[model samples]
Target: MTSIEPEQSSELVLRLKSGDVLAYEIIYNVFVKELLATAYKKTGDRVLAEELVQNIFISIWEKRESLVIINLRAYLFGSLKLSVINHIRSLVIENKYKEYKQVSFQEDYQDTSNLVDLQDLSGLIEEGLNSLPTKTQEVFRLSRYGNQSTKDISSKLKISEKAVEYHITRSLKRLKQYLKKFYIFLYL
Candidate 1:
């Protein structure tokens, strides 16, 4: 596409705005090469560059009547620059999302695996709890599983607060001893 005078350019713009297919074709042929080159050089991806330039042409044709292009060359280049920036930003965000998913999935897998060990330790704790007296077992379950405070347990069971504390402490000590060989002892 050879250079056109200002008058010829404006005339082409008018024809394009009036839905002249030939005028649109002339504009595309003239600038597509330069626009494609700029997009490729800036983005360093030939496929993406071609897609960006194609999108710009499609945009110009679709919005011809609404477009306020003072200089066609400048407008095309500006659109290409903005498209490149937006595409790169989207790629960066996509990569970050993938990384987050990968890390989170691994963490969740580890937690899921740990849950099985916790369940095993829970079973072992329950087994050791049987060795305690019935009253001691009742007090420990009320405080730990039933979410009752020592004072609440005392009021409910009609036992002294000190008695309730003694039972809970005894239950913990017994469970700790029972689980001493396991890593669950660290948490206790």
Candidate 2:
């Protein structure tokens, strides 16, 4: 077997503590996909995975100054694992509560009520759009919110139809990925 770089984690951590935003971004860029994949595998929810990873990165950035991590990779993965477990546990609890509400409502001759609220979904969608890259976000808004056709979007933005389509598709795919986490919200 090949020898590993033992001090690599510490060196990265040192970079982080010295207020290197790029170092922090490098860390996030390196681990975000794996962290999200792990969360999705455990919970089978893409939206939750994305949201959880976003929060993880935000937390990491916020606490970077005080962080005392020996192994950055291990620390990040461990945090991700714990977050996934907590997310699943919360989902279980929410499901149980929903079931109980359904049963009780049925007994009282009431219909099933939506657990998620649409306003929340609208807010989340807006947030997701704003989080997208500028060009991607603009194309998405023109197509989705402005109700512009792909051809219209292309003409208006002075881009090719294919480029408009590509941006819209990518934006929708990302939105759908995050929305899947709040599938219950869609019902509302």
- lDDT of model 2 at residue 64? 83
Model 1 regions lying over 4 Å from their true place: 125-188
Worst 10 residues of 2 by lDDT: 109-118
- RMSD of every candidate to native, in Å, equals 5.4, 28.9
Give the clash count for each candidate: 0, 0
Write model 2 residue lDDT over 1-188, tens digit each, in one string.
Answer: 12225475577678888888877777777777778888888778899889888888888888888988887778888888888878879989999999998988786553223323456577778877888899999999998789999999999999999999899988998888778767864555
- Residue 90 alpha-carbon offset, candidate 2, angstroms: 0.8
Which pairs, if any, clash in model 2?
Answer: none
Provide the lDDT at 155 for model 2: 92
Report how far off residue 34 is in candidate 1 (Å): 1.5
Q: Candidate 1, TM-score vs. the true structure?
A: 0.66
Pick by TM-score: which candidate is best? 1
TM-score of each: 0.66, 0.51
